[model samples]
Target: MAKIAFILLCHKDPDAIIKQAQSLTAVGDYMAIHFDASAPRAAFDRIRAALADNPNVTFAKKRIRCGWGEWSLVQATLHAVEAAAEAFPRATHFYMLSGDCMAIKSAEYAHEFLDRRDVDYIESFDYFQSDWIKTGWKKERLVYRHWFNERTQKRRFYATFELQKRLGLTREIPADLEVMIGSQWWCLRRRTIEWILDFCRQRPDVMRFFRTTWIPDETFFQTLVRHLVPEQEIESRTLTFLMFTDYGMPVAFYNDHYDLLLSQDFLFARKISPEARELKRRLGVLYAAEGARFRISNEGRSLHRFLAEKGRIGRRFAPRFWETESSLGRERELLIVVCKKWHVAKRLVQRVRQMTDIPCIDYLFNEESCALPDLGGIQSSVEKRHRHRRALVRMLFDYYESDRLLVCLDPSNLDLIEDFCRDRAVTRLLEVECQVSDVFLVGHAMRVGLAGDRTPRETLNRLLPTIRNDMVHESDRIRDAQFDNHLRLREIDPPETNARAIAAFLGVPGDTAETLAETDHLFAD
Candidate 1:
């Protein structure tokens, strides 16, 4: 029988942690917990009292303060692991979990999985060999020392890094150790844990060096385990599933995400929302059920890739409200197809689609009434759009992923156009201005609003020829004079010239221009 001990990390949420600790209890299993030293002693006392009846649970003798990307997190983790080892001398394995993590699979599944494998389960990759370090200074973390807290004192953190760069200050890794990076979570064999802990005990000087290194929690055990254990015995993957959004922000789980949690093959789901008692209760029910099984599926990795793909667009959004604007991805070449009419944009999108494989998204803001699920084609007003206009425009940009993308823009989307032209770094903004608006459509809208009856298809049926002829006649001069100030503007003066105009603006070859011109049937009688 495999004796697995869990080291649970907690900083706050005493009630939640107590429930989590209580749920994970088993007669044979041991849990060693460490409340963050910064949290109030009263809160810690409440949690300790709540689990006092459980003989399997223990708290660290000394707690440590944890800061994001700081060395203290590693210290705190090791402190708890040591406590677990002391409390359960017969423990054969150590699994590091946190208050925000929950076992998605059954305990039997985890025990069986561990029993089948003699090797350790952890994510470890060579610093230089892997592209795993998604963003920020990679090898620099090992080479230079970090003093300021990345989250709390960012200015000082970056300023110090810059100063170090200017001074050419560097550090050397010990000869025997090759640095590796991985997630803070891991499940290691008892002997492997002993070796890692023993190595830390022996290497006082090395420990001192790691204390100054950036985010050592990710590297300390990860690098040491790689050095202490042989290659075959150390699996370079974690049993715990973690998902990150743009810029490596970890996604938190809520009760609403129950389906997604059930789909993961991994033993545990991390960073649960503090208030997700219902989610925990539901998962807890499945966990204690008979005939529980460990499923193998690509959904975990697929979901990650899916979110990453979504993150590559101009914007990335999460359930958190702040991410709506904060998580914008790398900007790409943006071509704004401007028109007052939705049909004109639709026709241009069709022509553009015919010409190139580059993604051409249509009707970013549809002027015509749009049919939505459970509702008939409804017209949205300027006031309704203004409420969530930024999110609305940004979401469309986020849907299509490409190095260069073209999107049809309503003339009403001026704020969006202005925003794009302003703050974008690598993005090049271009515009195709369609002079396709006519007075006939304007009259039709008024008729619909006042008379409560208007047939656009039949009405436009008769006005097509007249609208085509008057597309850029003297009736439009005053309305069109102010377009010169737009970023990289190109014009479609007459209905017949849309194809050629778009081709010329995009710098397409002469032959392609002719092909595009053949698409003028988009404005046919």
Candidate 2:
């Protein structure tokens, strides 16, 4: 069995870090902890005392005052790597992780995966061409020299950097080195770490150049690893799962994200907050079950079955079983028309399709009554027995890229919406609430008589309460205060204005004047 060294860089949440260390210790992995120098001494002391009895664990002697997007972050990592190498000389691999990260897979499984593969697992790509590089931001990070202040922990203004650039005071990166950027987390062979250290020592200029570069932690190691390792020897994927909200904020995993964590093939997950006590307890149980040293007795088997069932591991794993390989690539946006009122949903779909050329999926329950264009048969079957709604939605998400947009109409079913959000790790959803008065008109449109042959007004009166309840439930689920990117359609606006707003929200390109005009005419009736 290959010995793996874990280099954990932690600043806050010492208890969580200790728990992670303990879980790894249970599986026989050596850990080298490097707490940020700027962090409170109490936190460092607590972690050190917690791991004192563990012979396999060591601490980095030289700690750096690590700051985000600064050279200190890279410096801290280097110190941890060196310390880990010295402490566990025979260790085959070094896994870099943060304080908030927890191993989702058992140590034995991680070892098996790494031991079978000779390639280093590092997520790297061209800095200029990657999807993360938005126009001016890429140039600001790569081209300009950013002076990061340790005290304030912020970068200098772009204007100041530009002035320095004009004065030829900016540090120049090596022309020979191809800049690569990726996720900071990586798993590498001991030999790779040694090579990187040697390479840095040999070329001090490279280190100096990167010191003033923005987010050097993301670029420094990646650039060196890509340069040193053969393309075939690189897996180009990290073993850690990190979920970011629509506004690009890192999501802290809670009970809601437990199933999502289990569904992933990644070995580890990050940003498990302290508030997620239940999730932490569950992780403890899962880690014990999946640990290599865990003996599978009758009781153990039963506990394992319970954990697996609770996690929904079997069902969630199948969605991404086959990787998407279509030439169409991932759809940028998904327009889901989910309305209880079939006619209203159908109308919205037609207006949206007319307004924007973006592809849409019409999944209304009353498919027969949805008198809309087939449009490549995106319409799903109304027969609930034929397909599981949540499963089908997951399939669509898996098929498309992560950046796609989904527009669900009349999502009165809060439970279904919650399931979709939880399964997909969707922190933000665009909710369009179409509040129409005159329930009798909608009832007439549906052409469904009430129980006991009651009049339309009486039937609507009975149904209104249920409709109101559903709306309230949905509002509670998709509370504006809860999510940063939950965009609600402005119901007070004109039909054309609302149509344009929806298009803009989905990031639909081109002029919406014609579409809006058409929508106004359609809704005019």
TM-score of each: 0.59, 0.57
Deviating ranges (above 4 Å) for candidate 1: 304-525
Score candidate 2 by lDDT: 0.65
Estimate the Cα RMSD of every predicted model relative to the unseen true structure. Answer: 16.3, 17.8
How well is each residue in 39-74 modelled by candidate 1, as lDDT tens digits?
999999998888999988898889888898899998
Model 2 lDDT tens row, 1-525: 767899988888787888888887676778998999988999899999989999889988897787777888888888888888888988999999887888666666777878898988998899877875543567567666777653464345556676877886745468888888888889999889999989988999888788888888888889999999998999888888786653567767886555546545577888787788888777766654654432211121222232333323223323232322221123333334344444554566666666555445554443445333333344345553123554444445554434453444455445444444443243345555555565434453234321112223433454456545645555655563354345555445565665555555556543564354345433222
Candidate 1, poorest ten consecutive residues by summed lDDT: 370-379
The per-model lDDT (C-alpha) reads: 0.67, 0.65
Say which candidate scores most in lDDT.
1
- In candidate 2, how many Å is residue 267 off? 0.6
